[model samples]
Target chain A: METTALLRQLSEAVGPPGYEAPVAELIERLWRPYVDELRRDPLGNLIARRRGSGAEPRPVLLLAAHMDEIALLVSGYAEAYGHGYLRIEPIGGIDRRVLLGQRVWVHPRDGEPLPGLIATPPPHILSQSERKKVPPWDHLFIDPGLPIEQLEARVRIGDPITFRADYLELKNRRVAGKAFDNRVSVAVVTLALAALLERTHAWDIVAVATVQEEVGLYGATTAAYGVAPTAAVALDGTFARQHDVGEDEAVALDGGPAIGVGPNFHPYLVDRLKEVAEHHEIAHQIEAIPRGSGTDAWAIQVSREGIPTALLSVPMRYMHQPVELLSLRDVERAARLLTEFIADLRADERPVWEDEHGS
Target chain B: MDFELLHRLTTAFGPSGYEAAVRELIRKEVAPLVDEVEVTPLGTLIAHKKGSGPRLLLAAHMDEIGVIVSYVEDKGFLRFAPLGGIFPLYAIAQRVRFANGVEGVVAVERRKDESKPPALSEMYIDIGAPSREASPIRVGEPAVFVGETVRVGERIIGKTMDDRIGCYLLIDFLRRLRTSRFDLYVAFTSQEETTLSGARTAAFGIEPDMAVAVDVTLTGDTPKALPMAVELGKGPAIKVKDRGMVAHPRVRDAMVEAAEREGLPYQMEILTFGTTDAAAMQLARAGVPSGCLSIPCRHVHSPGEMVDVNDVERAVALLLALVA
Candidate 1:
């Protein structure tokens, strides 16, 4: 499969936090043929399991990528000048400053995705002091180009609206689009499932597309509670460097996939990933998150009896924005590294640690 | 008998997820008292005192809220996000200690107009890491206040007093449990500030019949605060309710009656905000009757949380009476 095409399909899917059925269905269609059995929990997390031919008490390897993305919900609507303006609040983490005067696609439950643009006061009409203050999220509205009665017939209170930007291929192997913060990871996990299905792996592999990660990783917590895998890895995106951004803080876009290592990361799992990266010659960078990682790993590490977990993050630029960007090389590398790591684990043997202080 | 052990447990640096130091210290303290002790999968210390009866769990989280290195700027300055709920107003101009023994001061960026309290995003810690490579501190290292426990007019002011005080009380309680009616399981849990992960799992594994969580609550005596009924020097506060979980009615009444019979000076604690491990334990398996015995302290979740030493003694005494 073409990586860019998969990314495009993923970016075009509509799945916001707490509403992930459409995206989960799309992912199930894409990955069903590649795994032994596919299961979804009540939280709409799609888990594709490929069982090893080993005996009972087989060690399970869970590779998770969240399917939900940040979007807007229509809270209320009003009519002015024969056009319907929908009041909205962000359903996930969104920068209020970037929403001004941008085109969006509102996906109401009953009708087609309607086109709209963020309506804000004209800068020239505002006083100098008023221009300096950023408009609050409540002040912004979406003009959906329809009369109030017609809009009310189609749109509802909880309709999701996403940015209308198309996926763009940038220079130097970088591709940008909305929802790439996690959809790119979803595509990578799909590719890893494809790779693992072709070979006979030693451990049981579970490819999980979790939901509600953008909110608080709620989906991964419940899915982890149910799965209770011995070892797990969450594939997600990390902040990448842009112009004027702190270089020390940013992981480079093409630098490679990042391996999260620290107190939150299991030490033995980190070593295992490092060993697999070396063996497969995959380009990988080390990211140390000493405390709670604010990711699915935070929930996964402390699941039932505690699952030894690690995080594999593809560097993403402009995260939580309409135009999140990632390098294709990094995405493919993350998939390859995860595939190698899962294939290397043994069903009967536990990952070895130097001492009992595993963190 | 071992004041040094108590001092070591209090002075050791272990914030929420990174609680190895505190866990090790508690392990040493419980080695002689319990028959067998092991660290739980969630970094909680589960010490077992063998007896043949229903299981009773006593929980004290070992982790405290601190800061994690979020990003390092180009100029080698470190920006941080709090590991738990840290008041940005109190964080400014304070000292922090890194995991690698590096010291840093958290300073607010001087804006042209500074009227409002600095947002946590605008704050940075300067560890004197000249460059990204030389900093030794990576994005995700945990840092806490660089301070030691001290006695200030019958009060103990120290870093991580929120849960470490409870840890000390658990150690003292384990030492006093000679003939137990119930099989006692004492757990020093982790990540109580971030999520109740440690206690949740410990309860699932132990499957206790009843549980009592030991943690700290805010004192009403602090100047210009809400009118909470709890106060310092009033012994341990028997928690009625908090933002997280309501104390079990049976367990709450029992604790109150036990405190009254023992003549232990106790106060009714009503925490409008914040939670304890009792909340997580309450939701375990059909449900366990759970309650919290909180020590009233000033400036909870801060580096210099103030607690009265007499309250600590009373808290331990109440636990002894409940078990006896």
Candidate 2:
């Protein structure tokens, strides 16, 4: 698939934290032919294992990217206009400011996907202090653009809703859409797997489209435990260059992927990946995560006994909001860097796992 | 009732992202009873018992809401961020102890007007260090409430009753369980107060047919509190919904059914603010039918968190009924 087309296809797929079947299915289809074995774990992590030609018990190198997106869901309703106006809360992390004037996808029970818009209460109707404050979730409601009675009948509490931001291929190959926070990471993993398929490596590669990562590093934690990989790398989106963000926190967009360095990342893995990025002249940034990276790498690093984990983050702009921006070059670069890193790995030359029991 | 065990668990130095001491205690307690036990990378303890039927995951986080040292000032006062859902209103004036045994008093950053409420960020921990050089605590270290469990007639009060109470129930259940119809996987999870990661991964690894998280729920029986139906001393709360999840219909029915079968008094939980390990468990894999058995707790996430012993015991019984 064309990178932009694939990006749009995955972004448009409605998969909240728990509701990831649509996204998982699309991943399964794209990932099936490239791997030796593929299956979905009990927690809905789509695990695709690309077998190696090495000796028996080939050590696994896992790459995880969460398929779930930050979206909203119906929480409850209050009666008004002879119908229940839907009160909603975010599924993952969403800035309330971005929700203003957003088109939303409401997955209602027993019907077609319903189109909804956040009701922007006019400024004239608001009190002085109320106008200054972005309304709390209690005060926010969605209008599905149906008749009051029909809206009430169509929607129910707990139904999943995603933002309806159409993916835009921007000038200079920058793309904008919702859920680039992770959907693009999946794209990178796909590109890496496709690249790996054309090469030979000694270590097994388990590309896991992990679930419920936006909620926490849930999917990565379990996949780490289940796969018990010798080493793992979580492909995720980091903060892209923005004037408001601190220099220490931001990664330059189009600068390949960020090689993570921090407590969460194994120093050995970090050095190895950094060396490879340098060797290949792959544009990369160094991201410091002194504590938990708030990515799957944090959870995966601490999974049963510990898997030496590294984080490769694509720089993204306007994260957690609709229309998150990304550069396709960074995605392709991360894929190539990871593929080359795996290709360079000798099955016997493992990550620093001897001290897994300690810190 | 093992008040001694409860006392130790409550007083143990275990905060989210740091659960070694708590895990050590739980390992020794349940190691003899469980068929297999292991610790996850995230520091959660998974103890399993074999059975012939479906896999059942029962989870209770061992982590408690605490604070992590974010920055240390020149005078040694530590600025901290909450490891979990902790309100600043209840935290001020409380004592906290770090993993390394350094104790500190929580003090709010001053406001020009004393009447205004301080946000959590506007709080600091004073360990009585004369200067930054004299301080024993380092930035990034975590500290939990310094309190001990006390039995006040039918009630027990302590810190972290929000989850240690649930852990106590699970531990007691593991020791008492004889034969079960389903395979049991009990995860003494970690980082729930912060990440809710332990239960989520444990559930996915076990691939349980159904899951239940045991935790503490807020009660409104206190004077002039919000109009919540859950009351302290009421039997286990069968969760219907919370901030994170709507219980699967079958899981909700199963709890109610078990409660009825055991003739145990149970409240229907509709928590407005807090979420539990069940919320993360339900999201694991394809999705497991999940619900919670909550012990009614008051002053939750505080040093004075209180739970009725009767409620705790009944919660155990209801869980047994579900298992059988």
Candidate 3:
């Protein structure tokens, strides 16, 4: 499948933090044909492994991209003037301002997805003070345009609600959708897996479509523990250039993919990846995550003793918003670069870091 | 009955997202009392007691507010960010524990003007690791206040007593309940301080008719606290409202009636800030009527939240009476 087609399907799929089954199934289908074995752990992390030809205890490389995205959970239902307005709390780190006036799809328990839009007060009705203060997420509700009984029949508490929109391909080679944050990475990983299947590497590879990365990197933590890989790479999205965002600070959308360096990133592993990128003449940038990268790399790096992990990020715009954007070229390059990097790893060249226990 | 269990549980180093130790401790405590106990995909320990009536969900979040190592500077000094709501004033000059069993002291930024309180961003934890590379502490590892529960007068003060006190109460109640009318599901939830992910999943899987969240509430006894109406040692506070979820009127009334019938002193807690699992539990099914039984606490969400041991016992008694 084409990367854009996969991106569209992955973006449209409903998989918030605790609910990742739908996306996991989708990922499994996409990855089933290219790998030797595929299994989902108890935490719903889709792990697909391809074996290497050599039997010499080669380094195991983990490639992770979170299948979950930021959405809303219907906390309570409010009926005003016979119309149902569902109260919602954010599932992940979503900007409250972007939520207002946007269309949403309410996935009720047993019925069709209901169409709704965030209810916003008109400027005429709002006082100056009300206008000045940014509305808290609790103050917003989804107007489903249905009566209380109709809504109650279809929608229940804990039903995952997502943005009701399609991916838009912009004129500047950017793609916009609700969950481009890690879905773009998902697309990149899928493409990388497809490329990897056509060749054999010295290292075994595990491509993981992890769940709950938006929440707290829960899926990656368990997956890393279960995989116990020698080396891992988390393919995720990072901040990209947007309007008013500084060009110097922001990674451009078409700037291939950014490799994270600094504290959270393993120094030698990052150096090796950069060397591979340079050798292959792939476009890449460097991101300095002085503290936590706030990605699955944080969890993967410290799982059991220590795993030398590197984070390869696709530059994405409007991160953590309803409509996150990514460049198609960057996604393709990230997958290609990772494929080349993995193919270059030798059996005897496994990088080691100082374990937490000082072994 | 098991003070050793409590000691281990309270001493275990865990913050909101980093709750493996507390989960393991609670798993051991409830292993015998529960027919089956399993940690959920979200790290919540769900201990089930099979019965013949409606399902009853009991929740106590094991996660507490702490700090995450943001950066380790060249001098082995570490900058931190509060994993949850931590008071900047209280964190200065306090001790903390990293996830890897490393100890550190929170250092406040030296300001030319000594009168000002340091911001959370300005605070750093200094563990004698010598250099940045030598420090076992890595970025993103959670560190909590290193303190032990101490009895002062009639109250117990410690780090993470906010909901651990509630966890202690749940363990006490489950151990004492010889017969239960409802199929009880007691969940020691994770990440309640940062997000409600654990409670959302636990409640969905349990699918209970009612949920009673045991947590801590701010008390009016604290000096200059916005009149919270709940007083410390005034028995368990039955929560009516919080920023997250309004208690179902029926559930709230049921607890009130139970307290009145048992002649247990109770207070109505209306929290202006922060929420509990009651929010997520209320919205779990088509709508489960959910309420909260909170132990009135002073200095909530801080390193040293104060709670009366009597209040903890009363909260357990109220839950036992209600579930019985």
Candidate 4:
């Protein structure tokens, strides 16, 4: 599948947290030919294990990107004027401020994902106090333009919903549309896995499209424990530099992947990823995460007695909202960095944190 | 099902960052019931009952929001940061208990004239030590709302009901199980009030096919409160959506189906504010379809939080039916 096209579909797919079957299935079909064996773990993690050329029991290098997206769900329904409207609640860390005017896809229980607008009452109908405040996000509702019974018959409560916007390719190789968090990194994982198929590496590679990272790196936790990789690299999106943000806190959009450094990351693994990025001349930034990366690295770092883990971040603008901005070049660089890191891994290598500040 | 257990669970000294006492209590009750148990470094207690392929993660958070000492004053007053979300208005004038059994009262800075409400920075915990050296609570020590689980008529009123009710329900669910149809992993998660982080690791390890959060949620049936559809004593709430997650359709339906099949009293929950472990559970590996069974409680996150005993019982029933 074309990377951009797959991203568009992945972005469009209505796989909310804990409900990533649709997106996982899509990735499975795309990755089936490249990987040796693929299985869905008990936690719904899509684990694609490719044994290394060296040996069957060789150390595993797991590359993970969460396949889930921040989304909405049907919380309650109301009917009036023979028309029914649905109230929604958010699935992940959402900027409720940005939810007021986005077109959305309401995944009904039995039909195709439907198109709707998150409609609100007119300013005239709302109270003065209500007008002054951003109405609580759970108070937001969707209007599917269907009558009461028709709407209820199709869209039941708890069905996952997502932003229904087309992925737009802008000038200068930039792309936008709900790329807010990890779908781009997921695409990067897909691209990297595709690129690795033609190459040989010493160690085994486990390319897992993890689930539920938006909630708290749960997919990576379970998948990492099950995969029991010797080393892991988590791919995620980071905040890009805005005009007001200090350069220290943000990365640039056109920059290559952001190589994360922090307590959650293994210093050695981070050093290796940075070395590979430098060796390959891939554009990248040194991102700092002093305490926690708030990524899958946090869980992967301590999985079942712990695994050495690193993070590759794509610089993204408007994170955790619809229509986030990032350059495709950044994604490609991240994928290349992952492929290079895996190829460079030596079977005899085992690195642990002796002291965070030391070698 | 014992009030004494609920009382002990509710009264256990644990804030978001300090959950040792709470975890120890839950471990004792849950150890004999499960085939395997593991405590993660982040302070989550996970008990597993292995069965079939599709895993089921049952979550109940152990930690509650409280004050953490940020500054110890010469006069022995303690300036603090809230470990989780603590409304300054509700927290002011409330007494708190530290993990080391020290007691204190949250006090707001006094102003010369009648003034607007103060911010958390203006407040201090008064622990009756004359100086910083004499004070038993030091910087970074956590203290929660003074432990008290009171039975006022038929309602259970106390602090930490926001999630101790959840912790209590998970234990009760484990003890009452007849047979496990799916592989069951019950996570007595920590730091849910802070980040929902512990459940993340436990869920990853358990990776159940479906999951449910047993937590307490806000009810709108109070006088002069926001008009919410949920009310105390209506029944256990099967979450539709909250700040963290939208319960998956199949899981939500299964909860509803279980309630209907068992003829259990239940309410459909659409929480406008606050979140639960379901938010973490739903996003755990490949995304196990997850939902929440909330015990409707009034005055959530307040010292005098209230939930009907019947609601707790029904929530246990609804969860049992969903997983079974």
Candidate 5:
């Protein structure tokens, strides 16, 4: 599948944290040809193991990218003028500024997702002070435009909600959509797996479409423990340089992926990734993740006596918002860099601490 | 409760990544108690007492919230970023102690309007050095709040009681524990204040069948505090829901049953903000049923956090009853 088309489908998929089956199904179909074995862990992590061309007990390289997106959960139900509206609570860190005027989907237990519009009091009805303030979760409601009886019967409390934004293609190969904060990274892993089909590697590659990373690094943490890979790399999105974002914190869109370095990543793996990027002449940026990368890398690093984890992130604009933007070229570069790194790994070599290696 | 031991645990300089001091204290206290003990690469202290049943991982972080010097100014001022959640208003005018025992006062830059509290960036630590060259504290030095654990009537007050109190309770439980139906893996985790990284790995390594985190929760007993049902004088709060976790029903029920069976006065906690190590443990490896036992505290994330001694004792009893 073309990267843009796949990304668009991924962007439109409604897979909130704790409910990532939609995205997982898509990933399973796309990653089936490139991997040797595919299965879901008990916690719903999509694990695809691509065997390496090495002897028995081959070193494993785990690639993790969260498939879950930041979304909302219906917390309560209310009625205004006999029309039903639902209150919401955030599933992850969602900026309140973008919640207003967004179209959403309310997924119930046993029915097709109901289309809804995020609504607040009109400007004429809202007080002056209220107009200046972003509506609180309690004040904002999802208007499914259904009658009271139908809304009550169809939508129950605790239904999952997702942004209903369409993927938009922009100039300079940049695309805008929701859930690209991680779905693009999932695509990167897929692209890497696809690239690996034409090449031979020495280490086993387990590409995982991790779930519930938006809520916590649950999927990655569990997958790391279950896989116990020799080393792991997390693919995610970083903040692209945009208005109001500082230069130090944000990278340039379409420049390349950002290779994370800090406490969350082992020094040896960081160096190895940089070496691979430079050797391949892959355009990339060094992101100084002073602490946790707030990605699957954070959990994977500390999983099961600590896996040597690294993060390669494509830069995206307006992170955590409904209209996230990123470059397709950056996504491809990240995949290429990862594939090259994996193919470069030797059967005898393992990503460990510098001091852990023999003097 | 041993106030002296509590004092030692609370006063120890273990802030997030720098948890050696506190880890050593715990290791010394727990090494003799458990059958085996080991420190993970990320510095989480895991001690196991062998049992022939489902493994139960109990987590309590030894690390506390602190600040690391990000920039040392030419004028000897230190600009720091918070290692965890630090409020500028609550931290202003407070003293902080570095790992080397160098003390500095947190002070905000004088602004044109003092109506709103200063941001952390506008605040600097004054260590009394005249210039950058003479500054004893270098950049990247981490410092924690300088407050000693003190007894205020029936309540114990101190800094970092948020989880040190939890650590104390675990130690107390280990001392009193006679037998258990499940394999008890007590993890004195690191970096709960920052990333919960210690608990994350420790849980994975143990791969427990179930886990419970002992930590402090905010109380509404204070005047004009947020409307929570918990208070310091109340018994341990059984986790219901927090920002990070919706406590697994089975694990949460176990705690509630433990409390009810023991006839302990426990509160059902529903904290709208903040979370504990149980959130990380709950999702470790496929998934482990997990919940938290919260020690209701007044003024969380502040220098003068207070917890009731009675509540602490009750929590220990409840844990013992649960394990038994």
Candidate 6:
């Protein structure tokens, strides 16, 4: 499958944290053909390994990308406007401002997922103060438009909910859809694995589609310890330049993936990535994460005896929302960079940490 | 109470993500004492003492609250974001030393209203550089409050004492502990001030039967302070509940029993706000029962956070008794 098509399918898949089966199944199917071994971990992380053409027990390069996206959990049932509604609480970092009037899916205990719409009172009916403010999460409810009896029977408390947004193609090879905050990076790992098939690499590749990263780095924490790769790189989304975001804090969408540097990222991996990007003429930006990257890289870095970890991010606008936008060119560039970096890794590679003076 | 060690730890620079220097100091201090020592990838220094019994993980964060340089203006004024809870009023006129040893003073942008104290967004660090190019500090650099640890009456006062004091308590406990029935894992965790990342991962790796976070907590004894039971200098505070966690009943009772058995003065803590490494440790895979032992602190999160030395000693004693 092409990058765009694969990402579209992955993005549209519903995989809220702890309940990532749908997306995990899709990934298992997509990765089975290319990988020599494919399986899911206890915590539901999808791991696929492609053997390298090196001596036995070749060094492993772990590529981590969380498959979970920001979603909602049905908290309770409420009735207003002569209709029954399901109240919600955020599963991750939901942008309350963009939540009103969104289409969503309510995953029930049985049967097909129920289609729902997020609704709030019309401005005319709301008090003067309410009109000027975004509705608090409690004030917003998912209108499945079912009667109280049916809504109560079908949707129980704590049922997982996900946003519903159509995949859109823009003028400049950009795509916008729901759950792209992560599916973009998952697609990057898939594409990279596909590209590495024709290349000669000394290091084995362990590509993981981690779960529960949106809630915390739960899957990455356990997966890294189980895999214990020689080194690792986490693929995630960074903020792209957009309104209200400063230039220093955001990267450009079409400019390519952002290679992260700072305390969380090992210096050697960062330098190697930059060198490879320059050599391959791959467009890339440098992202400085002062402390925590708030991604799987944070957990993977401290795994077991500490694996040297780096973060490569696809820049997207409007992250953690239904309509996250990104450039497909950037995704391809990120894949190429990863394939080249893995190809350049030596079987006997040893990590070198800079001294106190970083000399 | 090893005031010299407390002084050294409180003065060390180890903000949330940048814990290298502190980790090295601790690695050296505990290397000879423990059977094995390892610094986790995220910079947590975990020292293990072999035992045949159930594993007990004790976490004390080496990292402290600080600020990260977000943007450096052309005039050398650096805009920053707080790595942890930073009160603008507490920060103004304070000195901050960067990891590179470059010093800066905290100041606020002038506002027309002047009615309210400046928010962190309105605050900037003046590193005394004439231009951005001339400044030694760059964006993404971290800086902590520069304060001297000193003995004032019965109190140890300084910056980073909120956690370094906790580190000191753990170090003291490790030094004093002779033999234990429980396997001891002492973790000098990182990033507690920011994300509690260190404790969360350390507990997962160690998979301990139970854990306790040795850190400082607020006291209500101050004049006109919010009414609560904990008070400075009276005793070590045993956490019952905090904003982030309710101490696991088994662990909480164990601490109470240890304190009572040791005859060490202790207080039950119910903090209205704030949390510690114990909160994160308790949630680690399959759940590990966890609680916190707190040194009563006054003026928390300031350059001169004050902790009673007697309280520190008692907390260590209680911890040693628990492990025994």
Clashing pairs in 4: A18-B282, A44-B286, A178-A323, A212-B283, A219-B285, A222-B204, A256-A283, B55-B208, B55-B209
Q: In candidate 1, how many Å is residue A43 off?
A: 3.4
lDDT of 2 by residue, B1-324 (tens): 889999998888777756778888888999899899987645578999989899999999898878877667788888776777787888988899987788999998768878878887678899999887889986556788888789999999999787888889999998888768998899999778766777876776788999999999989899998889999887889889999999889988988998899899999989998798898888787888998888999988778999999998998888888888
Q: What DockQ, between 0 and 1, does each candidate earn?
A: 0.30, 0.07, 0.03, 0.03, 0.15, 0.23
* Residue B288 lDDT in candidate 2: 89
Candidate 5 lDDT over A127-216, as tens digits, reads 899899998778888999998789989988888999999999999898999999799998998888999999999999999999999888
Tens digits of per-residue lDDT for model 3 on A222-296? Answer: 999899888889988898878897543466678788887644556567878889889989998876553456889
Q: lDDT by residue for model 5 over B144-200, one digit each (tens)?
A: 988878898999889989899999999999998998999989999977887888888
RMSD of each: 4.1, 10.1, 12.1, 13.8, 8.7, 5.1
Error of 4 at A152 (Å): 1.8
Winning model by DockQ:
1
Q: What is the lDDT of residue A11 in candidate 5?
A: 91
i-RMS of candidate 1: 3.5
TM-score, cand. 5 vs. native = 0.62
- Per-model B-chain TM-score: 0.97, 0.97, 0.95, 0.96, 0.99, 0.98
True contacts kept of 4: 0.01
3 or 5: which has the higher lDDT? 5
Docking class of 5: incorrect
My TM-score estimates for the predictions, one after another, are 0.85, 0.61, 0.60, 0.54, 0.62, 0.80
Candidate 6: interface RMSD equals 3.2
Q: How does model 2 fare in lDDT? A: 0.84
lDDT of each: 0.84, 0.84, 0.82, 0.80, 0.87, 0.88
Candidate 4 chain B: worst 10 consecutive residues by lDDT? B138-147
Question: lDDT tens string, model 1, A259-293?
Answer: 88655676678778889999889998877564567
Over B1-324, each residue of candidate 1 has an lDDT whose tens digit, in order, gives 244665787778777767877877778888889888877656778999888988999999988788878677767888887777889987988999986788999998888779888888788899887887787787767788776777787888887778888999889888776666788999999778877778887887889999999999998787798899988998899999999888998888888887888999999888999999999988876789999999998988776888888999888888888877
Model 3 / residue B220 / CA error / Å: 0.8
**Per-residue lDDT of A1-359 in model 6, one digit per residue for the tens?**
58789989999998999889999999998888889999899999999999988898788889999999899999999976567899999998999999888999999978899999998878889889888999888788999999877899899898999999999988889999999989999999899888888888988899999999989899999999899998899999999999898655677779999988666777778889999999999999877676678899988986765678999999999888788999999999999999999999887775553323332
